[model samples]
Target chain A: MRATVLYAAGDVRIEEVPDPVLHEPTDAIVRVVRSCICGSDLWPYRHMKPDPHGRRMGHEFIGVVTETGADVGRPAVGDVVVAPFMYCDNTCEFCREGLHTSCRRGGGWGIGGVDGGQGEAVRAPLAEGTLVTLPVGADDPLIPSLLTLSDVFCTGHHAAVCARVRAGSAVAVVGDGAVGLCGVLAARRLGAEQIVLLGHHKERTDLGREFGATDVVTERGGEAVARVRELTGGDGVHSVLECVGLVDAFETSLAITRPGGAVARVGVPQYEQVPLGRAVFMANITVSGGVAPARAYIEELLPDVLEGRLEPGRVFDRTVDLDGVPGGYAAMNERRALKVMIVP
Target chain B: MRATVLYAAGDVRIEEVPDPVLHEPTDAIVRVVRSCICGSDLWPYRHMKPDPHGRRMGHEFIGVVTETGADVGRPAVGDVVVAPFMYCDNTCEFCREGLHTSCRRGGGWGIGGVDGGQGEAVRAPLAEGTLVTLPVGADDPLIPSLLTLSDVFCTGHHAAVCARVRAGSAVAVVGDGAVGLCGVLAARRLGAEQIVLLGHHKERTDLGREFGATDVVTERGGEAVARVRELTGGDGVHSVLECVGLVDAFETSLAITRPGGAVARVGVPQYEQVPLGRAVFMANITVSGGVAPARAYIEELLPDVLEGRLEPGRVFDRTVDLDGVPGGYAAMNERRALKVMIVP
Candidate 1:
């Protein structure tokens, strides 16, 4: 089975790896049909040296189940499914609370000894709970969009939910990445009255508008905050979605969030400390949101995608084969592509 | 007028000051009937040297409107009213959003050029909006309880409200001062099923119990969090009310808050920064709350106090005449009293 593997900084390769098989009653073998490069992957690809043993790369995927273990019940072989970035048993207290990201016995794909998702076949732990079967056929053109349910789309939804977006909320999304663009979609789905996308890239901002952003503030840092305030008539937005993991994004999220509002962050935090004490207490804003519980959100968000009401797939501006995974990373890293879909 | 004045650390004095007179069209002259020393006051009293020019002290008060400015509307002269620690014009955008603490024209009593509430006669800005009239006579025994509506009690209420306290919430209050004790009462009033008071003082904890703390964790910092976690079956409390301004108290509040839960802090944060990035984001916890909008809550809480349903003033363990205001600060600073009331 061919899989994406990282050997060192900027050294991504498609290499033949052993095909995964069911090792536990709770496990299943998923034949990867669609996988994608994540923004977070670029962190290690651009900075740290990959393990000498070669590290498996991808966490976001959509696939067909090739085989199921004895303990698997619902999802049968040949069924198309969305695999959230992390796997969980779905019955742990945390999972029951819809926080599968904090599942007591769960681990993420491609990390912590789990087989990565960007492969011809990968072993899925807790397949019964971690995989959500799509009602649509495997050959549907919506595959790329459905692929987003595994991560970015659900992450965006989590940000909106954390910010408590409602029918009349004025929302600001602080990143122009795929996840942030999806946040515009999610905020619209939640019926936000106005949406502000703070990004400088014309291409991404255009996509953000298509995803339902009512306003675009092409600025950074304090200037971006000023722009958002100016757009919101000086009260600032009711909710802010911090989708970029950078400190500036977090700072701007806090700055432009109106008093009594919230700044919900789905971006993986990169800063070791945040200045909530120096500012938040005085402004009375709720600093909320974290890793998205994608599995919990799949069922609720799937119908919209299946009905052709949502096109999150537009975020996948480029598509490639397993062999082109490295090129996909390059495109994303160079800001030439919003996201890359790898069809294995 | 005679008022509590801060001359230096350990040198609180009852000094002669110019009597307050209504200067603005919306102002009111209030004869202080009941005022209490707050926990925040001890900060300056025990830490910083007061400037040679004496600064006015005290913020919590219930008083009679001795006179009204031209624009004063609701509470006329002779009305007994609870003066929220801060004053705001109810018409401002922020005040309309129940964030009077951030109102454009809002100002805190006893700080930033405003007259202190402990004075014999203090002119209140935004008198029409900042004062909530008491239904009962000025001499009612419940005046003490009604006075708490001016700050601590309402502040605690703000903490619980900001934390989004629900009917079955398991709440932990991370302070033993009057405000924390009031949080116990506030959480109970909001229908929390279980409340934990994280304080070591027997006297204060006893008052906490009376205010409906179902459990008390006496340890501080990490140990206190361990006790709280143990009490909540290792998942942590559904909500934490941070009523202590210290950094340790803030840390414990975040530590003890359950995943997807929140810590609401109404304790004027004394810390410069907090490590929200270390744990909060991963845990899906919200750090919210700030200065209480006491004016927003006073009306809703007054009937409960007037009807004897809530007795927040039980937190006042000591009382003094106007001339003994200096001794009141002394007792509170020395830790001999939980709170002190000045009978002017």
Candidate 2:
């Protein structure tokens, strides 16, 4: 099976690797149908994070199950499915409390502690917890949206949920990438009457408007906060979704959220000092959310996608063949594409 | 008028100062029947904050309206009153949202912001919003408890309310001073089933126990979190009240709160760098509370104190006459007294 592997910085390659097989009774082997580049992958790709020996690429994917272990009950072979970026048992106390990302024993894919999904075929651990059966046929054109459900859509929803977005509330979304763009959609779905998207790029801002962003703040950092405050009658937005892990994005998120409002941060935090004391007491803001427990929002958000009530697939500005995986990574890295979808 | 004046750190003197007159149409003059030293006051007395420069001392006081300002309504002259340490116009939007401490007009008393108590006659700003009339006679023996309603008691209730403490919730309180001790009582009133008081002194622990602390963890920092987690079946407590404005206490408060729980921080933040990125997000904890909007909770908490349903005054271990106010500041500053009440 051909899979994307990283040797070092700027050394992504599509190489033939051994096909994955069901090693546990709760595992399943899926033929990757569609996969995409994630913003988090840039950490290792850009050497911002240490590059381990023989690292596999990608975590977001929609696939067709090729084979299921004996213990698998729900997802049948040849069934189309969209798997959340991380797998969880879905029954632990943490998972029961909607913290599936922190599941005690459910670490599964793409993360350093888990396996990767950018391959012709991949082994999924805890099949019951990892896979969500898709209603679309294997050849359906809705694959891109289903592919987004694997991460971006659900992550955006989780970010909005963590921020407690509600009807008639104002929301500010940091990061104009797919997840942040989807955040605009999520906040709208949750009844946010006003949405502000902080984006430097015109295309992304346009897409954000399509996703229900009523205002676009092109500035960043303190200036961005000032712009948001100007839009919100100087009180700042009622909720803010921080989708960029950069220090400026985090600070901007905190700065733009009104006092007593929640700043839901879904960005994979890079090394940075978060001023919790000032934000906690001085601003009286609530800070929480990371590694969005996408599984928690999947069941709730999937219906909207399936019913065409949402078009999160707009995030996939570019699509490529399986052979173009390396190019997809390069394109996303260069900011030439919002996201890259690979059709296997 | 006799008042306690601080010319310098540790240099308090009971001097004859001029009687306070109405400074604005919104200000009233109150005769201080009873006023107490607060933990926050010690910060200035010990030079932890800026050195005192010819200012009055106390902020917590229960008094009688000797004179009324032109705009003052509700409280007539000679009415027994319990005003919060800070004054706020209750008609403001921020006040309506229950954040009276952050009222738009910069409403706060003592610490050189406005004329403080600790005098025979103190000028009260936003008089109608600041003063709460007591139903009992001015000579009621409940003066000590009612005096607490001016700050610590309601500050403690604000901590619990901000933390969202509810019936059967497990609560951990950091800082065993008067405010923290009162926090235990506040948690009990909120119906917390398991209350842990982190204290080093036996007297404070005894008071904490009397105020409904089910357990006492004298250990500080990481060890304190361990003990709290041990007591809470390894998951940590559902709510935490942090009343010590120090690095260790703040960190401990964050450490002991369960994932998805709240940490109500009422301590005046003295530290600059509050690192709260990965660990905070990973824990899903929400930090709330500030200067403990005492004005917001006084109406609800004051009646219980007057009826003897709550006894927050037990925290006052020492009492002094107006002429002995200078010695009272020294005792509390030297750590020989938890709190001191000055009767004029």
Candidate 3:
């Protein structure tokens, strides 16, 4: 089977890898139907150290179940399904609490000898617990939107949920990546009355406006903070979604948040330390959000996609096959595409 | 009027100062009946730089209204009232959102020429907004508990509230000071089923248990984290009240929080930076809470204190008159007193 592999910085290739097979009674073999490149994947693509064996890539995918182990109770063979970035046993205490990402038996895809999502097939551990069955067929037109449930849309929803975005909420979304754009959509769906998108990209910000951003601030750094504050009547917005994990983005998120408001960070933080100094302390601001528990949110967001109320699939501007995976990485890394979808 | 003043670290004096008078149309002069030395006061007492004019000390008090400016509509002359540590115009947008600490027009007591609580009288700014009138008299037996509503108890309640403590929650408190003790009570009041308190002081831990700690772990650092995780079935607590603001305490709070848990910090963080590294990000831990908005909580907690359902003032183990305030500061600074009550 052909799959994506990272050999070193800026080095991605589609290589033949051994096919995955069910390794545990709780496992199932999933033939990948659709997968995509993620912004997070760019981290290693930019500066990953060289390795002889190489690392499998991708953590998001929607596929059809091809085989199941003896203990697999659901996701019968041939069922169309989507897998969250992490696999987990649904009955764990954390899973029961709707924190599947923290499940004791959970593990991420593409690392520690597991199958990567950007491949022809994946051996999904804890199949019944990890895969959410999709009602549509594998080739359904809604697949693009439904594919987002694997990580992107659910992550944006996580940011809004963590920030407690409500119908009357005023929100500021920082970053213009696919996740940030989805966050604009999530904030709108959650009824945020006012949203300011802080991004310099005209094309992406335009999409952000379509997703319910009432205002756009193209400034960066202190100027961006000033613009956001100006847009929200000098008090800043009630909630801030930090979709960029850079320290600068985090600082801007904190600076533009109103007193007593929340800053939910969905981006994987690039720095080790965060300032929780006198300013943040005195304003009574809250900092929350981490890796989204996509499995927990998929059920709630699926119906919206099926009903045509949400069109998160618009994030995908380019598409590729297994052979074009390497170019897909370059296109996204160079900002030529907002997001690239892969039809395996 | 005599007031507590800090000339330098370890140098406190009760000196005669000009009597406070109404300064703003919204101001009122309150005759001090009860004021207390807070844990935060020790911050300045330990290392304050000498000044030609000493800084005023103290920020918690209950007093009787002596005089009011034309615009002061409530707490008429002779009415007993409690003032939050910071004075805020309760009508401000921040105040209306139940975040009076962030009120646009709010300012802290004992700073910028404002009269300190440990004085004969205070010119309470935003009088109609800052003072919560008590139904009882100055000499009421509930005065001690009522005085707590001014700061200590409300600060603890803020920690619990920010952590989202609810019925059957497993909570851990990381300090045994007045605020942490009050946090135990708050957690109990909120119906947390399992409360683990981390403190080494037997006397304070005893009070913490009385306040509703289901278990006590006296270890520090790694041992403390292990003990807490062991107590909660190796998963840690769902909510952690970080009443100590040191980086070590904050780190422990993060370490012992269960995945997807919250750490509410009410302490004045002594450090400038906090680590939000991969460990915290992957666990989906939330770090929230800040300076308590006492005015917003006073009304909700007053009824409970009035009915003897809470006895937060038990934290005060010593009393001092105006002249003895200097000694009161020493006792608390030396750890000879849990908290000190002042009568002017």
Candidate 3 TM-score over all chains jointly: 0.98
**Residue A269 alpha-carbon offset, candidate 3, angstroms:** 1.1
Off by over 4 Å in 1: B47-53
Per-residue error for B138 in candidate 3, Å, reads 1.2
Give residue A95's lDDT in candidate 1 (0 to 100). Answer: 94
Alpha-carbon runs more than 4 Å astray in model 2? A48-52, A111-114, A277-280, B48-53, B111-113
* Better model by DockQ: candidate 1 vs candidate 3: 3
B-chain TM-scores per prediction = 0.97, 0.95, 0.99
* DockQ-superior candidate, 1 or 2: 1
A207 Cα displacement, candidate 2 (Å): 1.0
The digit string of per-residue lDDT tens for model 1 on A300-340 reads 99989988899999999898998888999888999998899
Q: For candidate 1, lDDT tens digit of each residue in B247-283?
A: 8898888889888888999888888777778467778
Per-residue lDDT over B1-344 for candidate 2, one digit per residue giving the tens place of the 0 to 100 score: 88777777777778887778888888888888888888988776777334445777777888889888888876999899988877888878778888777677645565544667887778888889878999888778888888888899888888898888999999999989999999999999989999999999899999999999999999877888899999999989889999888877888888888877888888887776666667777667777777777888888887788779999989999989988887888888777999998888
TM-score of each: 0.96, 0.94, 0.98
Complex DockQ per candidate? 0.72, 0.53, 0.86
Backbone Cα, N, C clashes tallied per candidate: 0, 1, 0
- For candidate 2 chain A, which ten residues in a row score worst on lDDT? A107-116
